[model samples]
Target: MLRYSNRSIFGIMEGATVFYTVESNNVTNLHQFNQELRNLFDRLRIRAASDGSSRKFAAGNSTGPYPATIYALMQCTPDLSKQDCDDCLVRVLGDIPITCYGKEGGSVVAPSCFLRYGISLFFEPTDDTLQSMGPPPQAVLPPESNGANATIINEKKRNASRIATIMVVAIISFLILIIYICIYLRVMRKPIGNSETTDVSSADSLQFDLGTIRVATNNFSDANKLGQGGFGAVYKGRLYNGQDVAVKRLSKNSEQGNTEFKNEVLLVAKLQHRNLVRLLGFCLEGSERILIYEFLPNKSLDYFIFDPTKRAQLDWARRYKIIVGIARGLLYLHQDSQLCIIHRDLKPSNVLLDAELNPKISDFGMASLFVLDQSQGNTRRIVGTYGYMAPEYASHGKFSVKTDVFSFGVLVLEIVSGQKNGRFQIGENTGHLLSYAWENWRKRTSSNIIDPIFKGGSTTEMLRCIHIGLLCVQENIADRPTMASAVLMLNTDSLTLPFPTRPGFFMNKFSESYKESSEFIQASANEASVTDPYPR
Candidate 1:
């Protein structure tokens, strides 16, 4: 049996409470890449629901996420499904005092569920009650003595001085150890590929000559420029076969682009999916590296979703179709494809619509893939836009298939509301659109969450879609439904959906603070400032 202590530290110092888990088996579903574990947990927490029969988060051993043989136990209240468990956790994070406030070993037992962690060993029973290991051990000390031996005292003083000197050296060594630990943790917390690791993989592929691309793009003239990204600019060109293609030219100073280019070629070249953008070929000449892709007539999903005038062209019917199409595309990446990919930077900008209005998911430069059986992973650095990112992933560098689900949830909400989640503004409160929507949902006023553009559409369909979106953005990675379930929910009207508790990143105090700010007034006065928070 493991001997654990129950004694609390006596000091003003607060006990450290690390938000992490230790699996009995090393076989964690979370891959140690791109914060996949954090993303997966956020997705699961949000997708679980408590509605009768069809609760998104079932409590039975056989239910919940993955399989029981996997020891998959989600600890929400009995009344709450896995989904409810996730919602409460999301909210609880906000409730944790701005300044730390909690016992060394204590729990917050909500009416529906309980959140806990303790210093002492507790029994892992399937209930709320905890079985403490026992009382703490008492320390044994040297006995007191009379002043019968002044000589002994002098000898003891010399020994005491030596011991103090040794202790000081030990303390200095301990401090150094702590410093190293902190440095290691900080390094581990950074995103996987930073400037230091510039060389990604550069597997041999169908290469193009720089002279060939330069002639095709007319030496990359301004007229040839198609679009611009963080790494480089894209240019339009015609290949030898008279095929129209897009050429991405990396900037001379861009280290990230160089790494991404190599990574994309090595990973995406072998992947074949309808929704994924096709990489026809690439070029690698001295001081010149370019990627060639099949160019789509329409640019990206954001150009339509966020532009009011252009958005009008995408009527509810068309937008709805686009939303479902993207879901199908994601399903292909996550499940139905040859590789189980998690698009770390999924957003409107990453999605491209073809001339026929068919949606294709693009931008594999920041994507991560895992084995089909794996469910989650972690990262050191967190990328992606703020509003679209799930809380778990943003805060803890965890991600997985479920991480994509959280991004998809944000996408679904944006689609239905015709609002940019990253830049949504309501009345005086400024918060993530997902959180704003959640507040309205809890008040049974989700109808108000719909976009004014779709004022005359079907309320039932809109409501259902909103419900589904909320489910996608749940707090727990396990609670979020799979892409398979999301596709089914969107395609099938017969399926029932449970109430959504809330999405992640709902900072109540921050919203309140923004509501009372003068900057908000300035933003409110300018319609342009009322932009979507998401970087579409």
Candidate 2:
């Protein structure tokens, strides 16, 4: 509960009297002047509405003879309402300064009424009245009341101190609990032998804000969607500082897939090369696992080399650069880097191109890390793209650096012929690009193997790339040329090309299977189509 008090004073400065008097048209209109006077006093009633209080006020004036003037003012306590409002004002007005001996000036100011007058105009304009007030008289109390008030004030101070102390303790307790929970989760979440951090640069290097990532990809809108893969959809994003980025967000339901995710973050963090796609930063917030990479404008090699219209833009010169770029990238991954890495899913689709059509080996999702001295490894699951998989790797689950060489060989042939390795079909060849290329090479009609669209391209250069491709697709892993040697042979004119032997696991009956498979796919598609039958 709260209490309030108020007071006001009024006075006038005068010298001489004026002879003019205010004259209204009718005597009954005197109520109009009284209403205006009441309205003037109403302003003080609504003054303290903000503090949830009610008020009322009233006032009156009298003009005597001898060219005298009259002034009147009125106000009410803020804690009063409408009826109380008018009643309080009327009471104050009834006790006007009639008792004060009339001389030249006088004033009447109570808890409500406050008026003043003189012989001349005491205020600025005739229609306007001054709304000024003096400060209220300070409240004073008896000794006993003062003692009780001091005690109550002291009690309030003590209560405030106690509340502040409790609030501080509660805040500290909450922070400590949060720290402990974080530590427990960190310890329990990590897989055995996993490192706490992938980089030694700084603890905050990989940290990304939620708002920052949202703004980068335009809140992950459909327009910024790059592509979808096994992990999740990739988004093309732009940061606040205008840095273009590719964001890979992992799917939550992907169970045993994060093994490669962790491998890539740790491996790429330590290694840096122009051929390898750069990892700008990473994020692990709540359920979000995002890997931010430098944006590659040209997209994947398959997007262009396999496309009918886009493939036209890639002449022999551009295609050769892409092939050599991929070789250099693979060479760095296999031998130059500290970790001996084998990209298990090396294919045309996995090789991304930059602005100048330079190939950068990407998609380290199925990558395997080998020790420096280790040469090979075998996996039972055998996870890889069907056509690009080497014969030994696909059938026996044996893979090495040479496994990637086999895929590279298939990519080379596809680039030259403008066809997919798996889509090759004639009579029996269905899942065989090497067999088709080798058969065309042996028939002395290798010119038929050149892409019909590249009819204007040099046959000599085309034959050279085809020959190198055959060498890389040999049956034995040892027979395949290393990426470094392949790059050197392609670049140098002085090196004598070696004769390629019988190709790896070439099935003579592929042409027959190809025909059967095509018929089956066609039949399946027809069965799936909704066709309306008409009676003949």
Per-residue CA lDDT of model 2 for 479-507, tens digit only, reads: 88999899888888778888887777564
Ten contiguous residues with the weakest lDDT in model 1? 527-536
Can you tell me which runs of candidate 2 are displaced by over 4 Å?
1-204, 256-263, 366-372, 425-431, 509-536
> For model 1, what is the error of residue 470's alpha carbon versus the real structure, in angstroms, after optimal superposition?
0.8
- lDDT of each prediction vs. the true structure? 0.59, 0.60
What is the C-alpha lDDT profile of model 1 across 1-536, one tens digit per residue?
Answer: 00112564221122122222222332233223112222333443443433432323321111124222211112343344444455655543322221112222233322333233323333232211111112334434454543445557657756765664476346434544554575578667656743223224224324566756775798899999988766578999975435688898865653445455565565566557677788777776666767788899998888987887888878878878888888887887777754566776678877888888788887665333333345676766665665666778778978777778888988888888777775466556556677678888888898877777788778888888888889999997778899999999999999887766657766564666434532332121110000001100
Listed per candidate, the RMSD to the true structure in angstroms reads: 26.4, 27.9
Error of 2 at 501 (Å): 2.4
Check candidate 2 and list the clashing pairs. 54-80, 55-80, 56-85, 58-89, 427-511, 428-510, 428-511, 428-512, 429-510, 429-511
